[model samples]
Target: MIWEVFRQEKEGEYHTHCGNVHAPDREMAKQFAAIQHGRRKPTNNMWVVPKEEVGEVDGEKYSFGGTTDKSYRWATGYNVTADDASEVVESSDEQEDAERRRSEVV
Candidate 1:
C-alpha cells in the first residue's frame, strides 16, 4: 500500500504534503514516514494516511469561489484601531496581507 505524508514545520502552522511511502499497513507507514521525512527536518508533527483514501476533484467539476465581491467581510474593509494583544495583532496582520495579495491578484 502507498501512504501519503504531511509535515508541520512548527506549532500552530499548517501541515504541508511532504512525500509518500510504500508500506504494508498504517502502523508501518507511520514509522516509515517518521524516519524518511521527519528525521532530519524541523518537523513539529507528521501525518501518514493511505493514498487510496485521499480524493481529488478537477477544476472542471467544481466551482470553488463564489462570484460575489465580498470585500465587506474582510478585515481590511474596516478601519478599526489596532489591539495590543499579540495574537490579535498577528491575525490582523495576516488578514491585511491576504487582502493585499487578493487585491493584487484581482
Candidate 2:
C-alpha cells in the first residue's frame, strides 16, 4: 500500500505534500515518512494519509466561486469609518490589496 506524506515546516503553517512511502500499515508509513523527509527539514508536524482516501475535483467537473461577481464579500464593498486599531487597518489594507490583485488577475 502507498501512503502520502505531508510536512509542515512551522507551527500554524500549511502542510505540503513532501513524498510518498510504501508501507504495509499506517504505523510503518509514519516511521518511513519521518526518516525519509522529516529528518532533514524543520518539521513541525507530519500527516500520513492513504492515497486511496484522498479525493480530487478538476476544473471541468465543477466551477469554484461561480462565474458571477461577488464584490459583496470584499471589505471595500461595505461603507465604514476609519478605525483606530492597527490590526483592523492592516487587515483592511490586506483585503484591498487582495481585491486589487484579483481584479488584475481577471
Candidate 3:
C-alpha cells in the first residue's frame, strides 16, 4: 500500500507532505521513503507509517468552534498592533542611483 509522509518546519506552519510511495513491508517503506523524502537537500524529517495507520479529519465535518457571540470570546484572533504595520525599507535613493550607474556601466 502507499503511505504519505509529512514534515512540519515550525510552529503555526502547516506540515507539507511531499508525495506517496508504495511498499510491501516496513523495510521497503523506509527504503522508498529515504529516496523520496530524504533525497532532497532540505529534507528535515518525516512521519513514516503504514497507509492504514493514519487518521484524518475531513474539512467539512471538522468543527472549529460553536457558532455564537464569538467576537469577544475569540478577540485574540482579530487583534493586531501598529508594530505589525511596519514595513522593511531595504534600499534608499542614494543606493538606487549608485546601482543604476553600475548597471549602465555593465
Candidate 4:
C-alpha cells in the first residue's frame, strides 16, 4: 500500500505534503515516511496517511467560499475614514495591495 507523508518543520507551523512511501501497514508506513521524508529536512512532526484515504477538491470544480458576495468582509469594501488610525489605514492598504495582486494573476 502507498502512504502519503506530510512534514512539519517546526511547532505551530502547517504540515505540508513532502512525499510518499510504500508499506503494508500504518506503523511501517510511518517508519518508512520518517526514513524517506524526515531525514532530509528539519522535521518537527510527520503524518502518514494511507493514499486511498486521501481526498481532493479541485478549485475548477468547486467554489471554496461559496458563491456569495463577500466584499463586505474585506477591509477595502468599508467606506470608513482612517484619518488618525494608522493600523486601520495600514490594513486597508495591505488589503488593497492583495486585491490588486490577485486581480493581476487572474
lDDT agreement of model 3 with the native: 0.72
Off by over 4 Å in 1: 66-106
Q: Rank the candidates by lDDT, best first.
A: 2, 4, 1, 3
Residue 85 in candidate 1 has what lDDT?
59
User: Which ranges of candidate 4 are over 4 A from the true structure?
Assistant: 65-106
lDDT of each: 0.92, 0.94, 0.72, 0.92
Residue-level error in angstroms, candidate 4, position 8:
0.2
Between prediction 1 and prediction 4, the one with superior lDDT is: 4
Per-residue lDDT of candidate 4, residues 1-106 (tens digit): 9999999999999999998999999999999998999999899999999998899999989878778889998978777765757887899899999999999999
Clashes counted in candidate 4 amount to 0
Residues 1-106, model 1: lDDT tens digits: 9999999999999999999999999899999999999987899999898998888988899888788888899977776664545688899899999999999999
What TM-scores do the predictions have? 0.60, 0.60, 0.51, 0.59
Error of 3 at 66 (Å): 13
**Candidate 3 TM-score, true structure as reference:** 0.51
TM-score of model 2 vs. true structure: 0.60
Q: Given candidate 1, what's the lDDT at residue 65?
A: 79
Note the residue pairs that clash in candidate 1: none
Residue by residue across 1-106, what tens digits does model 3's lDDT show? 8877675555556768777789988788878987877777466566677778888988699876667666775747576675653442234566788999999999
